[model samples]
Target: MKARKKISRRKHEVSTSNLIRHEVIGLRVTVVHSLNDKFIGISGTLIDESRNMFKLKCKDNVIRVIPKEVCIFKFELPDGDSVKVDGRMLNGRAEERIKMKRRKVVWPLIVEKQLKKARFQPEICEVLMFDP
Candidate 1:
């Protein structure tokens, strides 16, 4: 007998705090930074997403494929706030990432990236943030 994968019907709000668990295909996205200089400033409607790449339809009607790992993205929320996310946090397949119940590591990685620029030790930030 083949086991069926149960899908989640509960819709989680798409906020900066829980954006990783929502479907982001129709949202607007911009490549805020990338390893390749040529890919910077590419703003478009996100049409498709994969584990390691994003397919965007730009204003010129061109579909550009952007690598996720090396790029930082600024995503526009429905409420008009833009959230900058490190692509590494979205490293897994969509279904797997969304369905994850315990994301103990995601926050630390993102916070560490931000705190690194602010000259804070990542270990200290992690311990404080996850402290009971």
Candidate 2:
């Protein structure tokens, strides 16, 4: 006579992403900051791109930064509509995890073409006026 035993195992499944696998290449991006009632902005043209990373070429500066560091990024599409993405820069293990998490949805080939002919220029720089 033999006894029956049950085995426990977890099923691993991959997920399909809805966010576009495309990267912002050669596009212009601006980072703005408003801290302690002071506003500051930096402008640069994009050079390198990963899923969540970008390197920019400024007029007098070169910055290799992460998307999370930006307060806002304005990208002009070939279609003529400016796509503005707003977010905050995050550091430490959280940032590393976010980058790692995006690996599955990121495709290098998808971003190469879009950034080939991109050239960004700064068109706006102004401090917000307070009307009190």
TM-score of each: 0.69, 0.38
lDDT of 2: 0.42
Query: Model 1, 84-116: lDDT tens per residue?
Result: 776766667889877776445454576557655
Q: What is the lDDT, from 0 to 100, of the residue 3 in candidate 2?
A: 83
Residue pairs that clash (backbone atoms under 3 angstroms), model 1: none
Number of clashes recorded per candidate: 0, 2
Across 12-36, the per-residue lDDT of candidate 2 in tens digits comes to 2111121122334566666653221
Q: Per-candidate RMSD vs. true structure?
A: 8.4, 16.6
Candidate 2 residue spans exceeding 4 A from truth: 1-20, 32-40, 50-52, 64-70, 88-132
CA deviation > 4 Å runs, candidate 1: 1-11, 102-132
